[model samples]
Target chain A: MLTALELIGIAAFAASGALAAVRSRLDVFGVIVLALTTALGGGTIRDVLLDVTPPTALVTWPYLAVAGGTGLLVFLFHPTVAKLRRSVLVLDAVGLGLFVTGGTNTALALGAPPYAACLVGMTTGIGGGALRDVLLREIPLVLRREIYAVAALAGAVIVALGDHLGFPPEPVAVTGSVVIMGLRILALWRGWNAPTAPKLDGV
Target chain B: MLTALELIGIAAFAASGALAAVRSRLDVFGVIVLALTTALGGGTIRDVLLDVTPPTALVTWPYLAVAGGTGLLVFLFHPTVAKLRRSVLVLDAVGLGLFVTGGTNTALALGAPPYAACLVGMTTGIGGGALRDVLLREIPLVLRREIYAVAALAGAVIVALGDHLGFPPEPVAVTGSVVIMGLRILALWRGWNAPTAPKLDGV
Candidate 1:
């Protein structure tokens, strides 16, 4: 079940990445590169921070195959894929939730400190999209006026708290994931925006 | 001797980063962040790839101190630093040389394959600057028309070949660094550029 959820998340992220590349009018190779980065970049960073050699994403052929295949599909059918933007956004929220919870659990299992685990979890949830935006020469949405990182950080904190307080891992994971997804979806529905820095005349 | 050289490279990169931040009109905190990222981002990525946990930059107080101190200095003395841009660029070339050679040697020592080591070397030479540009919402110069990555790759190839041929490590490292620095400086002086993709009418 966990593997299935992970694969779904990877696919969703890959699709979103491909769609973004298509919108940017990148070539097929660029689309594939973006898709793979978006799908696997976060997990790779998380694994590196936790000292997991080779990164699970790199060793697991399924992750590469799924991300690459999704990229190709989107490149060939971009018109149809573009029409599914709403669905992709909803699926991306699901991906973010799964990544944050799973990353936190992994860090905790590896005996990382609570604060470090929370940070690792947040990095895992947001790193890929941040990388994608960076490669596209744009400020990352998480670092801009978006509630995305806040939601991920909140989920990470919950997971870390659960682990610290001796709660059941399974229920805590589920709750954390739900909270992230719920907050993200609600923010979207309500057109909520994170606050930006106030305008100043000079430094 | 090697430690002193490494510190010099770190300081040079940090200064370059801080100067860029000043040019962008970032506040003090932002300037410091950019300086650290520019100074240590490449080594951090290389360490992560080689499964070096916590990263050398994170564990070593000297690295952090040098970078942060350089940032503070640049922030307080922007006009003076701006006047020294030419010297900074030369020092940046030196840093690129040291990082590329050092990164390749580190990767080879860790039992990575030759091709992977070469790529890692190039990444180590260019990664920090790439991150700086990405954070600044600009396309990385290495990925644009700059001859930067090419010079790094050429140096890496030489280092890898020398290692495969059982050459003395110190001499080989010196040769590689000299080649990279020479090539970069020459490119700057001669106004050489890497080729860009041809404009296409349609996808």
Candidate 2:
């Protein structure tokens, strides 16, 4: 079931990436590459950072196949998918929430400290999107005005808190996922931005 | 000294990044961010993948200091630095060559195979620039028309082949570095690009 959620997450992100590539006016191959990167970039980094030889993607052909198949569809049906911005964004948020939960669970399972688990969870949720924006030569949404990663961080914090409170794993994960999704939706609808450090001398 | 060489490499990459930012019409903070990312991004990824605690820049105050100082200088001295595009590119090539050797050495030292070592080398050499391009929202130079990382891979292969032949590390690294730097210079002078796979008909 967790793997199924992850596959859904991957498919959503692939579509999101295909949208970004279309916006960037990339070719078919570039679009597929971008989609794959957006879908798998964060998890790959997490696996590598953990030194978990062969990374999850290498061991899981289904993940890539789903992402690639989505990309192929987006390429063939550009006009149809172009109007899917709202739905795609929502699905991407689901992926973000799902990944945050997965990452935090993995870290805590690995015996990391609460803070470190939260941090890794946050990273797993947003790292790939950050990579996507960086590769596209755009300001990372996470680093800038977006409240995206903050949602992940919040969910991760909840995971830590719930574990500390001795809550059951299912409740902890479901509650955290819902919270992340809610916050992300609020952020998207309200255009919420993290306050930036002001310029020098208050000028 | 290795320290001096590292600082020089940082400055060279920072200057190149600043130049690119200026060309793209970015602001002061943008300039600094790009400079630092281009200078330190590759090494950061390498360190993270190796799971080095606290990471390299966090470990050495000097690396961050050098990168930040170079960013400041490049931001403040844009006009003079802009005139050195050719010189900066040459230095960039040399710096990348050195990074390839360093990455290969580090990976091999960590007991990785030649294939993994070569990958680490190529990633370290080109990863920073690729990260920079992604942040700038452009197609990465590595993904675009450039023989950049190919040069790094060739150099790494030289190191691996030489090591396999029972040569010492120092001589092997030096030979590989020189080879990468020379090939890069030749490629740049000749405006060479790696051949892309041909596109399919009506797809």
B127-182 per-residue lDDT for model 1 (tens digits): 99988888887667788735798889989999999999999878898899889889
* Candidate 2 deviant stretches above 4 angstroms: A4-15, A26-94, A110-120, A134-203, B1-11, B18-41, B52-84, B111-120, B130-203
Error of 1 at A200 (Å): 25
| Candidate 1, A1-203: lDDT as tens digits | 77788898899899988888887889999999999999999999988887988799999999999999999999999889877876788888889999999999998898777765776797798889878888776655564434686689789999999999999988898889889989888977665343534342100
Writing each residue's lDDT as its tens digit, candidate 2 over A1-203 gives: 76787898899888888777777777666677677778878887778755664456534678778887898788889888877766787888889888898888878887888998898888888887877777777677788745776788889999988987889877798789889989887876665243544331110
C-alpha lDDT (0 to 100) for residue B183 of candidate 1: 86
TM-score of 1: 0.59
DockQ of 2: 0.16
Please state the error at residue B36 of candidate 2 in Å.
Answer: 6.5
Global CA lDDT computed for model 1: 0.84
All candidates' TM-scores?
0.59, 0.60
Cα deviation of B85, candidate 2, in Å: 2.9
